[model samples]
Target chain A: MKILVCISKTPDTTAKIAFTDNNTKFDTNGVQWIINPYDEWYSLVRAIELKEADASTVIHLITVGIADAEPVIRKALALGGDEAIRVNTENSDAYYIAGQIAEIAKHGQYDLIFTGKETIDYNGSSIGGMIAEFLNIPYVALATKFELNASKAIITREIEGGEEICEVELPVVVSCQKGVAEQRIPNMRGIMAARTKPLKVTEPVAFESLTSIISFELPHAKAGVKLIPADQPEELARLLHEEAKAF
Target chain B: MPVLIFIDTAEGHVKKASLEAICYGAKIAEQLNTAAEGIVLSEVKDDLASLGKYGVTKIHHVNSVALNHLDAQVYIKVIAQIAETTRAKIIVFSNNADGKAIAPGLSVRLKAGLVSGAVTLPDTSKGFTLKKTVFSGKAFANVSVNTDKKIIALNPNAYKIETRDGVAEMIPFQAAVDDGKVKVTKVTKASGEIPLTEAEIVVSGGRGLKGPENWGMIEDLAKSLHAALACSRPVADAHWRPHNEHVGQTGIAIAPNLYIAIGISGAIQHLAGVNRSKTIVVINKDPEAPFFKAADYGIVGDAFEVVPKFTEAIKKLKGIA
Candidate 1:
């Protein structure tokens, strides 16, 4: 079975968020980047697990970004991706990025596809379903567990109040979160092998972005903390009702 | 299709988030000089006419038992049919779990531009621009939809629900139902009494609580305050609590009215998930804990002593003793 896993680069979870150019853009001065955890830990790792179980399975990783994202893609390849594809573009619009991947999937004839439920940066959980609609196939989002039996896949996804278990045939697309698989670190041998792996660069299609960033602003800072002594818990409660109005 | 709002319901009643969507759609309709209507696919037992208070002028009711359950494949097709027939220029949805699943598919099927996580109404004075939170609520972005048809999924708790004096007209909508490919077998619900997303007040703990056996005071505090229970990612990852109880960057992102942290070191990732909260209160023994910087109130005290007293105080205040 052939699988394509969509990957994205995000600021490291611990990166201090700041803006530059008068708070018009993200400040990348000392920020570190990593493969989004949802993609690396669940989507990509689960696909690799399937391949390890059946040697015939091949997992190809694809990302949409400029050359600056090559190291991020290389890390995914080093983890287990057989090869990598980078759609050459600096565009950050979710719709435009989804269009580029949809164009590729239309021609690649992939049997299955995987994507993170949402990126840690933009947190838009829209691309996987859009790709499925573009290809006119079944799409599932926020899947926690998946099992492939022959041509059918049984999946579990979280809902508002509970979880749902469903089955879809091959040629399905799924957006994965945690509980699907554990994170895997690339060993020295995998890193060495990844250096010679095929990394394809493709140009983005002619498409206009639907959204543009006007400016970026930080959240308002909180007022200085008002600490209430532990022994006077009742006074704390009174303050919450009269001042904070939390009750 | 006039400005259409998707009303989400479960157990025969409309969800609170959908009320906000209705108001949002109505506001947009007022701006566009059009009417705002609602589309209900499932069997909503609640009185549909009462939704008029939220600005919906009419309700297109599809009363089908099969439609009660959520199926994105079927929902996309049915909604598309309505969009085409009504010639709806814009559709509105509350960006909850269901909206996140269905809106994207509908956007692709209708060849529409979709903006999820919209924080405010669209700025239409200048060719349809929407300001939304990006970078995990760290920054904002202005998005302009280039398509003729557009879908906007407003983030939960980001919009206010207003009531007006009016009554909605209910009309039956005929839709073809498809037997979806996926089959649901079993559903496992989170053990917490209140879902974090829908909760107004939340009380969360972290590694500072020590162990699972020490969660009694935290649960008591949550119960006394009528707030949902949450935990830091480390607590959930360590198996001290269920995964659903986790709230952080990689976990559930919630924007409750009030968030109280007990013994939790506010990591940046954890802050990203909850910084949108209306107010934050932190209690930790470490006076230098970073959570204090972002909290409206802070208490430097041991969790073992502070939590029980806090719960008792809340119980006394609420007359629950």
Candidate 2:
């Protein structure tokens, strides 16, 4: 089985978010980059587990970004990807990125495709379904569990108040989240091997972005907290009802 | 051309988020000086015409049982055909699970610009700019859609529902129904308790609660407030709570009216999931817990001592037994 896992580089979870150039671009001066946690801990790890179950399973990693995304992709490789494809581009629009990855998936002809539910940066959660549409295949979002049998796969996903189990044929796209797999750390051997693994770079396909960012703005800061004395817990409730009207 | 709204339904009932979507679509229609219409594919128990009160003039019903459960591929095919037939310039959806599943695919199929997590009406005066949350609500971005056809998925609870005394004309529309390749085998519904995403008030706990054994106080507080229960990532990882109840950047991001955090230090990751809340109250023993910075109210006291009293105070205020 051939599986394509899509990953992206995002600011580390603890990075202080700020925008520069009049809020048109994110300031990368002191930002630390890492593999998006959902991609690393869930999508890529699940692919690694699938590969472990079947010796013939091949896992290929793909990302749409510039040179800066290489380190993050290498970290994914160390976690257990067989090969990597970089659609070298700086555009981060959801449609443009999905189109680029769809182009690669068409050529790769993989049986299954995987993506994190959404990138922590964009938080759009749209790419997986867009790619599936572009490729004309079945798409499943927010899968918490996945099991494979022969040419079919059984998947379970979270809904509003419960879980729904689904079965789809091969050549389907699935967006993964937590509960799909546990996190894995790369050992010394995997890290050394990743340094020598093939890192293929390809130019992006010509496509126009349907949407453009006009500007960015920071969320309004909260006013300083009102400290209610520990002894006056009732005052908090009274304030919630009278002043804040929270209830 | 009218603005089209996708009315989502589950268990034969219209979803609250879809009501918000209808109100949003109506306001957009008012801005564009056009009519607002709706389409529902599921088997609904409510009178379709009654939804007109939410600002829709007409509702196209497919009345297909196969669509009761979401089949994204099938829904996309049907909605795309409907959009084309109606020549809809704008499409609206509630950015919930079903919307997240359908809108992106429909956008690609129709070659339309799609904006998810929209928080406000589009600024049609100067092109089509829409405001939406980005970076998990840490910031906001104004996005412009250059496409002739545009789609907006409004976040749940981001817009208020409006009602008027009007009945919509219900038109039965004919469309092909296909179950597609994906088949749902079984469904296990979480019973009774309110789902976290839809909860207006959320009470969450973290490791400072010490162990699962001490969760009774947290439960008592949540019960008194009639709020849904949530936990931090560590609590979920430690198996103290279900993963679904874990609210953080990596878990489900929730935007509630009021969020009360007990013993959970406000890490940036945890804040990302909940900073959109209208009000926050933090209770912790440590005076310098990071959560205090983002809170609207803080009480520096141990949860064992403070949470019970807080619950009692709320009960007294509400006159609950």
Candidate 3:
């Protein structure tokens, strides 16, 4: 079985968010980049688990980013991805990125594709569905569990009130979240091996981007907290009612 | 060309978030000097005409049982056909779970530019640009959709629901339904009075609460506030709470009206999920817990003592027995 996992580079969770260039671009200065937590902790690790179960399973990692993303891709490779493909592009538009990944998936003809539920930066939660639409394959979002049964895959996804278990054939795209797999740390030997792993760089295919960021604005800072004494818990209630009107 | 809104329903009733979507679509329609129309694919038990009060001029009902459960592929196919038939220039949806599943695929099918987690109405003064939360609510971005057909998924609780005094015309729509590729095997509904995503107020706990045995205080506080229950990642990871209750960068992201955190230190990962809330109240024993910085109201005290008192205080204020 062949599986493809999509990885994205995002600022670390603790990074201070800021915009640059008249608010048209994210300020990357002093920002520490890491593999998006969902992609690494759920999607890529789940793929690695599948490979561990079936040694014949080949896991290929793909990223749609510029050369700066290679270090993050190498980290994912150390997590058990056999090879890596980079669609060398700087675009942040969701459709364009999905299109690039779709182009690669079409050529690879992988049986299964995995992506994080959403990127931590964009929080769009749109790529896996778009990729599925672009490739005309079945797609599932917010999957918490995935088990393969021969050619059919059983996936449990989070729905409105609860969870829904669904079955789909191979050649499917599943966007994974927590509960799908446990987080794995790379060993020293794995890190050493990842340095020599094949990292292929390819140009992006022609595609029309549907959206563009015009500008960015930071959220208004909170007024300093109103510290109520432990004995005055009722004051919190009074303030929530009369002042904040929270009810 | 009219503005079309997708009405999401559950258990045969329209969802609260969909009402917000309707209001948003209606306001957009007024801005464009066009009519706002809604389409529902499932068998809805609610009075479809009453929804017009939310600003929609018409509602198309498909009345199909197959759509009761979400099938994104089938939904995209049907909604695309409706958009084409209605000549809808713009489409709207609540960026909830179902919308997240459906809107992107529909955008690809229609070749329309789609923006999810929209926090504001489009600014038609220039081109079609609107504000949306990005970086997990750390910041906002004004995105422009240059496509003739545009899609916007409004973030839950971002837009207010305003009702006017008009009834929308109900149109019985006809469409062919196809079998979906994915077959649902079983469903397990969460046992909660209010689903965390749809809750207006949320009360959450963390490791500082000690263990699951001490969760009663958190529950009492949540019950007093009529809020949904949530937990920090460590609590969920330790199996003290179900994973569904976990809210953070990697878990469920929510934007409720009020969020109350007990014993949580307000890690950046946890804040990413709930920073969009309108008001935040933090209760932690540690005087220097990071959560206080993000909170509108905070109490530096032990949860065991403060939470019960807080719950009683709320109950007294609200006249709840």
Which candidate gets the maximum DockQ versus the true structure?
A: 2
Regarding TM-score, does 1 or 3 come out ahead?
A: 3
Q: In candidate 2, what are the lDDT values of residues A109-194, reduced to their tens digit? A: 89999999988888888999999999999899999999999999899998887789999998999999999999988999999999
Cα lDDT of model 3 by residue, B1-321, tens digit: 889999998788898999999999999999999999999998988999999899988998888888887878888998988999999999999998889999999989999999999999999988899999989989999999989999999999898888889999999889888888889889887765788888999999999999999999888888988899999999999999999999988888899989999999999989999999999999999989999999999999998999898899899999995
Top-lDDT structure, candidate number: 3
Candidates sorted by lDDT, best first: 3, 2, 1
DockQ values, each candidate: 0.67, 0.83, 0.82
Docking class of 1: medium
Reference-based lDDT, residue B205, model 1 = 93
Q: Regarding lDDT, does 1 or 2 come out ahead?
A: 2
Tell me the tens digit of each residue's lDDT in model 1 across A125-188: 9989888887878888889898899999899998775677888888899999878998888999
Candidate 2 has an fnat equal to: 0.80
Error of 2 at B85 (Å): 1.5
lDDT (10s digit) by residue, model 2, range B115-159: 999998999888999999988889889999999999999998799
lDDT of 3: 0.92
RMSD (Å) per prediction: 1.7, 1.1, 1.1
Which 10-residue window in model 3 chain A sums to the lowest lDDT? A157-166
Candidate 1 chain B: minimum summed lDDT over ten consecutive residues — where? B183-192
**Residue B10 lDDT in candidate 1:** 65
Tell me candidate 3's fraction of native contacts, as a decimal between 0 and 1: 0.79
Query: Backbone clash tally for model 2?
Result: 0
Report how far off residue A21 is in candidate 2 (Å): 0.9
